[model samples]
Target chain A: MKTTNKIITNINQVSVDQVGIGDRVSRITARSVKNEAKIQGLKMALNMIDLTTLEGADTVNKVKQLCYKGMHLHDAYPDLPTVAAICVYPNFVGLAKEQLKGSGINVASVATAFPSGNSSLEVKITDTKMALDAGADEVDMVISRGKFHQGEYNYVFDEIAKIKETCGKNVRLKTILETGELGSLDNVRKASDIAMYAGSDFIKTSTGKISPAATLPVTLVMLEAIKDYYYETGIQIGMKPAGGISNSKLALHYLMLVKETLGDKWLTNQWFRFGASSLANDILMQLEKQRTGNYQSKDYFSKD
Target chain B: MYIGGKFPRTESGRYFTLKNAKGEEIANMCKGSRKDFRNAVVEARKAFEPWSNKTAYNRSQILYRIAEMLEGRKAQFIDELMQMGSTKKQADEEVFTSIDRLIYYAGWADKYQQISSSVNPVSGAFFNFTVLEPTGVVTAIAPEENGLIGLVSVIAPIIVSGNSCIVLASESKALCSVSFAEVINSSDVPGGVINILTGNAEELIPHFSTHMDVNSMLYCGDDKKSIQLIKENSAINLKRIVIKKDIDWMKDEAESPYFITKFTEVKTTWHPIEKIGASGSGY
Candidate 1:
């Protein structure tokens, strides 16, 4: 399924063996990170977090508190770095920007009928514009899973290109595949290639609203796609694995995967980020535990 | 059987048989391993903050509900105790006292703070006072004798003050502990708040004593070597260790507010006081 055209191509060329992917992920997880390397990995994971709060019950006060948490982390542990970004709904983008000013933390907003992407293309373009106009440093847009499922790869690619145009050059564009709903690892690999080829600065795994949100194997498939895209176009795409990553250990595994798959270029927050809310606190607790030589409790840490 | 809120057989799939007076195997109970104790400690740690943060009134209501549930299941408990070689009168008395002991601690839940706290007479212009707080997660070894009454006495005080516990039931008389776990399950007590494991104390106590996450240890047996082991290993984390022996739990003197205070930590606070109009103020 080769294409002579420059823009769209066949995703069927990307194939994944289900059993082999599982076996590789299991081996990756079994390799434990310990001692000095473990501490560094934990701190590095903490810095790459995109602290997020996307809920229907979200309020202005909650977003503001989350912004504060992004900068402060934990007062007891001094010299700790703040997270990479604070993610929120598009409507709260302006408020988060105002609250997080001068903190060097990016304000990321989820757009394009996020999580479902069931809205029309016109609505999705308007959603992207709303977020960008409100000073969002980054825009996370969801791909139309319905169109992709219906074998409308051309439509999916066109919509992503259109959204990238709406985001312009200043704001980073992240195309979420919502891999949990994609059914198979083979589909996840295809979606990653489609999003990256259609002009996305980042290819994210999920919207944090789906079960089996970001498994190791799914992320591995996306990482391999990013690596292959870099090889073909000499352009590096970022990766963010959102949801079900509530602890420090899993976050470390993700860093290991990114480093091994995409090399040292994607090791920093510029190319890799965790779209997680609770993962920050867990990392903070671990850092504190390492410093004090004792196990820390959630009571000592602040709730975001 | 209660590991993480649900009743499950031991992960090791090993059970110990209980013999009656005639040496007949009457029951088979789970012989929990180090893994089971570790799991219970994890659950206890998870349930600590939510259970400890509950208002005293709410905790009291839950304790009273347990007492109510125990009263309703009195016949089953008596029958189990009788099968464990307790005479009918002894079984009846144990069941009766266990209910009253729960009631006793239920009354103490809200009032223990008042009786235990105090405002200090400081020399400086500062208002200083001390209040008691739950000691996080605690692990207990239930007495081998008086299975019904002893289990209640050890658990009622620890939970009355809002601390969660992982109790290792008696090896010889283990039937009644599982029944109490059922009573706890139906009484609105949160899962993981009171985990009961039926196993040999010698096999499971070291894990309880050495676990870095557990904050306190409560042992009720008379085993000197096990107590020494608990003391030696608990030094790693400096856990608060309380060892009891030869105390008949069915006796009236066994129930006291001191037992509740034993599982609590006194936290003191100092607040600056502003002097007003040169009048001496007493708090």
Candidate 2:
């Protein structure tokens, strides 16, 4: 109830218990309008990416080439590289499901108190079930970093347990620690332990909301945690360092980190994933050079 | 001016160094002078036909797309501003304002002809009409205080109405201005419609303001001696001079007159609409 005023007035933190002046309302109005355009652009951009092939062309001609090449690859490589699943909010689980049918790729949707994970158990569990029922094969859920910081380790562990229980057979659970806010390598390691011990199929690095998500050091710490957990429990947890990675060199660096840290089992698309807006093209750019034996212009593949 | 994706820089690659706010050399900008300005004017003079002949709505669409591109690269602009030593808040505001300026010009491109009075009453049977037209190529000295926004404010208005400009970059900060030129070049803004330069205003502006071929001179310099030189130089060609103190484009829509006054070439076509009565009556 207090937040309505702050959201309406936009005076710093909405959660604060202070009365904001009318002057602040303009700031709020301006911010909301600004956010509207950005949100629309992001939604449209995401919808246009054909994630099944991860073959994006910057121009119309590139699109044609990609189309022909995709078909040829489909026919020839019959067992070609599988793209990571399409990620979306719970509402779009069905949409991802519909678009990716008979395509052998998985559909991943964030559920169970995503980003913040600041909600009741009933709500989180219900959200995960809905995503799975709507045909999400991989459900990425965020852990409550706030609770974890507040020494509510058991509470965080219980939430992941409920999600893992709900995931059942065909579905997998990715418990996100949001390491950016979680603070240090030690915090990341502990959070990784909690998620794996409670039976997460994978441990994710962020909600893509925080500033410091998915750094190599943070990810490296997480991989070490995953390896240690595997040595003790024999249950291998997957890793997805999603957010802000814009190219292939960074992805390759992350790949190198994973292979060195966890060894061969983590190399497959089943275990390793990079979440980003520009990472696909960077990967494809590398693939192009490898396939064609020449380096292309930085703008050769559209950065769009 | 070639009207394509590529705009030829002035024939002279001659340029001057631009400093950041900290007085460090950032870039050597393409320093165009009054001579280069005259050349750009000549190019724009040649280009005025096909560009102005196009429908207003089409011009407006092109301007709007320029705004979109600016919006997409707002972060990049801010980063450049930071490189040129502006704070984050100031950089962000300048970038956003630059984009808004494009939107402002976009709204005016089609409707600029309608916003003023054109009716004239004559005592005789002869009819007279007054419509705004481009004066010719504009010779502008862009403001130095607000880096990118001020630069766009001065340049966009002049070009939106089909006039072209020879804009001197800011004395210290020129990265954003040159970056803007790159954006305009990519946006298909007809070459010579905007020619950017970075150099000593005193050395370059004399030739620019005094050039007989240039139709006008826009001064951002408020100092008395500089103003005198600009005014004195204009005496040679009678260039329409818009002084700094006179224009406060920050508060209002400022693109219309800046352009209409510089680019429009007025020429009336006359034909006899009357026919001799009962002559050639085939009925």
Candidate 3:
């Protein structure tokens, strides 16, 4: 039998060495990918994106444009792959789903008092239910940082479990720790373990609303937790480093870190995803640069 | 040696030997590749907004500060000019001229926009006028002759208009360019406002012209083949290409408000006005 209960109980025992992580991340990022491999990495990163727009000002047209962008990406490059999914707020999930119909791009929605998990259990349950009812293939829920900081690990665990239960077996749950507020790398690792054992299908770094979002060092810590979880229960969990990863070169570095830490099995869209909006255009620009042998201008790319 | 706000070696790690008039090796200059040019353009683009948003008087003061720093290091520039085959008197003259050229451009910084802008009379109920704006980032190939004065002349005019620039220093006479970078660093001029690279103009000119992020290009040489290449590549982004051929930098005619206008774009605006009475609008 798997030792899920024991792992959850021992979450506090997981300590992250700040020095070791810093050195390893530097080494991983220093390994440059170039030429044909660079092109390949850029394409793979383009495919693994969860193009998100979760602003309070988001509208029907903006969500439609984002969904269209997810499918078309860049029509000039006929060989380009569409993004993995379209991420939006719950209200736009229905429209995004309608726009992305039959395009094979899943619709992900942020729910459960997203970016700030300050609501009650009933409110959180209703939030998840609203997203699922609107045809969200994935739900990105923020954990209760207030609870986690208060040493109420059980409350945090129960909240994620309740939302995962609402997700059923169909919808994947991406628990955003908002690592910028998590205080330390040790808390990040503990929070990763809690989300995984509480049945989160993906452990995301941030909600894109916080500073210090999804840094390479924090992503490494989460990946290590996922690796340990997989070794313990043989259940592989996905990783998504959302926010602030805008350029192609930095995206490649993240991919390198993933491959090195979690192995090749976690390299697909099903296992690894980037929750970013601007990252798509940048990757497309790099692909175009590789195709045309000239640096690209932002004027040519779409703003959405 | 200067990119972004720091002095860093070329990322390509390639170097070429610089020789004195006697053909003896003096120093190894960074053989900046297309990637270095690309990196500098990235920094220049990032630095454009803040640098351009600065008040004209502030930019004027910074340019004057560069002249002051250059004056303090006049002996070093004179020494480098002599190493590139100038006599003691010629070196002294070139250094003094370069410093004076910087001060000239500094004085022009806040005044050029006034002379360049114009009010136009339209045939409708509107006020039409035009004002000059910095043309984003510019890439230039410094003149091959008069090492220090030519570099100073090309750079001061372009940046005096609030445009950031990436300049390839004179290949044969590259020493003063590196020392000039030191002066720019110590001066109040912001980093990336002026990035100087030492490399072969022939190798870098194609990239300098074709870069989509660069808004304009300045070529100070008369090589027909290179000029043809620049004209062709600059078409990719429709970048404004200014070709200065056979210009003596030491002359008073070389430094003009027209030089600053070359790197500026005219933005014309029209504001609607209600007619007061049947007569034409009141002044």
Highest DockQ against the true fold, candidate? 3
> Which candidate number has the best lDDT?
3
Model 2 TM-score, 2 decimals: 0.43
TM-score top scorer:
3
Please report the TM-score between candidate 3 and the true structure: 0.96
Candidate 1 ranges beyond 4 A from true positions: A1-9, B6-42, B45-150, B160-163, B168-190, B196-246, B256-283
Q: Any residue pairs clashing in model 1, and if so which?
A: none
Q: Relative to the true structure, how large is the alpha-carbon lDDT of every model?
A: 0.89, 0.66, 0.92
DockQ for all models? 0.15, 0.03, 0.73
Q: Write the per-residue lDDT of candidate 3 for residues A1-304, one digit (tens) a residue.
A: 1444576668768789999999999998788888899999999999999999989999899999998889889999988888999999888889999999999999999999887989999998998888899999999999999999998888888888889999999899999999999999999999999999999999999999999999999999999999998998899999999999999989999999999999899999999999999999989888988888889888888888
Residues A34-134 of candidate 2 have per-residue lDDT tens digits of 23443332222222222321222234343334333322332322233435566667766676566556766567878876767888989988989889888
TM-score of 1: 0.71
Model 2 pairs whose backbones collide? B133-B264, B134-B263, B134-B264, B135-B262, B135-B263, B135-B264, B136-B262
Candidate 2: tens digits of C-alpha lDDT, residues B1-283: 1222344454566766766667888776665544455455556566656666667787788788878888888888999989888889878877887888888888888777776425455443344566766676677788876668778888777777766677777767777876777778778676656777666677777667655556777887577888998888787556788786555545464545545444454544333324434665332
lDDT string, candidate 3, B133-183, tens digits: 999999999989878998899999999888999999898898888889989
Residue A32, model 1: lDDT of 77
